[model samples]
Target: MSFHTPSDMKLICGNRNYSSWSLRAWLTLRKAGIDPELIVLPMDTPEFEERIAGYSPTRRVPVLWMGEEYVWDSLAIAETVSERYADSRLWPADSRLRALGRAMAAEMHSGFAALREELPMNCRARQRRLTCSDNAQSDVQRVSELWQTARQQSGSSTWLLGDFSIADAMFAPVAVRFNAYALDLPVPAQAYVAHWLADADLQEWMSLANKEAWIIEHEEVGE
Candidate 1:
């Protein structure tokens, strides 16, 4: 399938209040300045399958429907947008930086299972003093170290791997989760989280997320 008008491109997403993956894809599109039509649907509902079957084989949120072709998976969606809009600087400009950023994003896309399980992405909820499992703490430690390391490597840029790229989009949800759960981070990671929270784009998304009334039961943490 081929894309025609910008209006023809659609982003099929799920509940903004709970879907981390959706947020990743949506942020990537936004970073690329591609504002496609957003198609949101209720998740964990009986009609969810019927609603999303046409958009994704996996029946997942964040299916980028580019007229004739649809891309599922947040990482894949980010890659597609980067390739389609090379001028957008979705990835870093330097080849080595770009490669490293991709590695970080890829690791984020595939790892951090413990963190995800213990602290699901709850944008509107803040839970302080929740006990973390050893595994979860380990995951958090790794994340903090990675953030500090990336910042050091970035050399004066506020964003990871220097400049706002797909890697930042990938880690955006983690920043949200850290803030929501009151997870402790080292000075560097804490600063990185602050940067993400201070972003205008993230603030906009948070505003929309705050307006969402749908609450997924399992996603609510420390309640």
Candidate 2:
């Protein structure tokens, strides 16, 4: 239950209003009780281009700095945090459940291209309307099915699993997308999205997102 907080920990991220990957990593660290120094670089700007190279080899956001070592990619950061803070229980103890969680997280990470393109994670935007393509609709349906299966297996009505794990962190941005676009979903998935929107940490993130002035014009979809 106790772990040493790293003094040299820092998390380099992008504008919270539009960076779903950043949200994932930030939520994971916050859930693990680690508040790293957050460095927000506005995306699609000369500043980001110049500064990102110093922080991430991938030239991406949500890179975690543990002393001189840096971990890029949100999933990698989640895995590292889960391993380093085993006592935090970032993943379920049961092997089967853990496997299922990993699969779900991986699917979210690799798939859902249509959903990501059509329904970008705009935390500050809400009650917006968008006519999703067939592929995007299929993606939403797939996400609903995944959530239903995970909750049914774990008997958890709140989180995807019985507890808040890396799986939840991975899908947290999807929840924001669903809410922001007012995407029509099944009752259970709707409830899940509501739960995520109600999370205090996520609310704090959204609060900061709303205060951000820089907006990615391309990501400003859904009228």
Candidate 3:
């Protein structure tokens, strides 16, 4: 009956293979060093819809169940935890950096529709030259600009805003899209994607995804 944990937290997520939203929330939690009870639900599993009812009224994955409050949606959960744990550096420390970070993250949450539709996340798929449509290409260009500007503005830190903040979590799906579709990137975007691809959490997530037996036919790319 309770997804909330004793003190840390509990995060209910969807299958690693297709749940981009879940990845966003999970990355934020992992970055914050809050070990939540991770419960993975298969996207197409009839049980998934029924099971998620425990997390929130929305019956969606990436729901964070805290002590007394429940947060639905990936971005909302990220903000909630950030408010609770500032030491986690969920948002950029500086006001300007935070503003820019929110702008970029908002783009990630709301934009890139074409790219997302074209290149759904498939961790096991080895797509060396998957071609995206023109709309998807435009999305890629915009994403590349975002990466370059954020990386340039961040002073000494290695992440988007000098530290691995919510900005990085926001663009996590874009990184997957580029890798999934094998989209060619400019120098700066390519470098940023490279580091993101090599991330341990991403690697582990992909590895686990590859082993999953479940698959939603709609999300599967045409071979």
Candidate 4:
């Protein structure tokens, strides 16, 4: 029943093609050059519940197993990694920029409900010309505004922060979602998404996602 491994570090998540939260944690760890052994579970299966129940109290994916210790939420996993590797600048080194990144990350973690609900992450899909609600459009604009403001406030960088911080990880899934749904983003947000998609590690994750066989019924939207 234990997703726990003898290895000190492991990441337990669901199918890469459909799990946005899992992608967040996985991308963060990969960005930090920490390749934790990944345990992927098939969604909508009793086996998934039985296995993940051991690592997660919330009965969810993206649980980080640090040997006997485990971290359950994606944000918590990012924070744990950041704290463990402070010198790695998981958060920006500049205090002001760090605060701003945290704020953005927190917003990504909790807000954008409409955008998320409307455009669920589907890595294999090449959907285009999809209809979106006003609320979803507003959510997209808010994300664009946040990215534009973060870039303006921090000057120039590929990531939201001046460097690749946890903030980038927080928004990585959004980039994938936008790309998957063919959502047109504003200039700043478009550039941000482009930069992340070009990342080698992210490309690798997407490659793996494309190879997965199991499909979640809910994630197979719009045919």
Candidate 5:
């Protein structure tokens, strides 16, 4: 079925320079063909936390408001929209493929702490790839392995499961992190990153993020 015109949805997000989780949720909604209003909060501002209390139960960004439903957390938002709009094909159709997709997205939601903390998404800056702490390196290796395994198993598909799914949306911010930090990936993973970087929507996001006047000092990754 055609999704409720995404144009009607509203997505609340934090600063584009800092909120990777928010990016994940926003991209999922957009790819689902939902034209949600992008609500951005200045992470450094005192009102940031205060403002979120009304819309976000967790007091974080990337909150999804669909009609009366309030979805918090990036992964939850994606799943909610996908299930609500079956035609979006947010997950694969085959049972096993769908299961793998969920597994990947779950892994992303709960794991990869080192990479997330060390290389947080900073859309306004590009830094040379340099020393990664053991923890961060381990996370990077694991992500590359995930992508490799998924590509090999999926065969003809360009994404984790032959087509764009929640798995890709979950990893999308990570992909941006890799690019922003100039982290080189394994050859196959490098190719995947290339695909992600070339996407027009991502490019547009980067452009807007760079143009935004707000700056959150806490999220700045490098000098």
Candidate 6:
């Protein structure tokens, strides 16, 4: 088997309905004015298992291929895009705010395992019911706290850090999870969720997700 590198940037992702990490990287790229060649491989499929190895050493979705170079992780992809497209202002101009945003994004990347597992991202689903574990609830609260902190620190009511930075991209999937499950949240957090839901790019992603036919049962939680 042979792999051919594209002359332009390409992103290999999993299903839009279930792949939160894919959403993060894809949204980051879009925010940076990059419309890469998209390759969607439905999760838990033979095609994904067979083809992923060629694109990613970790065998994961959301691998970004920039010619021969590949970024296999979502946060790394965001960082790379920010560096390469500095004019895009993926990070804020203020050094303090940028540091805060990086910390928040990193937390979202490395933490929140329980919230992630219990409230799997199902973009096409809404008002679903699920009894979350204590850890999951705690994770949700922490996310809310992070958002509130970002808003308070940046003095921005719209997006975290006063603009749509990589931090917002990182937390975009969490907004989906909150909306899908109708999770009870504080007023500020709920407002942030509403803001994210109204985003055109997120709406487009969900529209595509709703049209997809592949269904991974294990991720089909909540009724």
Clashes (backbone N, CA, C under 3 Å), per candidate, total 1, 0, 0, 0, 3, 0
lDDT of 5 by residue, 1-223 (tens): 2334555578899877678888888777777766678888878678887888888778888888877878888888898878876474988887887888788889999999889888888877775465778999899899999988888878833788887889998998888888778665788887788788887767878888888888666676665
lDDT score, candidate 1, position 18? 79
Mind giving the per-residue lDDT tens digits that candidate 3 earns over 55-172?
Answer: 7888788898876778899998888778775464788768998999999989888888988888887766654466678998999899898888887887632578887888898888
TM-score of 4: 0.93
**Model 1 poorest 10 in a row by lDDT:** 1-10
lDDT of predicted model 2: 0.91
Which order, best to worst by TM-score?
Answer: 2, 6, 1, 4, 5, 3
lDDT of each: 0.84, 0.91, 0.80, 0.84, 0.81, 0.91
Best by TM-score: 2
Off by over 4 Å in 6: 1-7
The candidates, ranked best first by lDDT, are: 2, 6, 4, 1, 5, 3
Model 3 Cα shift for residue 119 (angstroms) = 0.9
Cα distance off (Å), candidate 5, residue 92 = 0.7
Error of 1 at 119 (Å): 0.4
TM-score for candidate 5:
0.92
Model 6 Cα lDDT, one tens digit per residue, 160-205: 9997899999999999999999688999999999999999889989
Candidate 2, residues 30-109, lDDT tens digits: the string is 88887778999999999999999999778999899998898999999999988886574999988888999999999999
Model 2 CA deviation exceeding 4 Å by range: 1-5
Q: After superposition, how far is residue 118 of candidate 3 from its true place, in Å?
A: 1.0
Off by over 4 Å in 3: 1-8
CA-only RMSD, every prediction: 3.2, 1.7, 3.6, 3.8, 2.3, 4.3
Error of 6 at 124 (Å): 0.8
User: Model 1 TM-score?
Assistant: 0.94
Task: List model 1 lDDT by residue over 1-223, tens digit each.
Answer: 2323387799888878778899899888777776678888889987778989878889888899877988899999898988896474888778887888888898899999999998988789775557889999999999888787777777844889877888899999999988888776888888888899998778878888899888888887684
Please identify model 4 stretches exceeding 4 Å from their true place: 1-6, 86-88
Task: Work out how many backbone clashes candidate 1 has.
Answer: 1
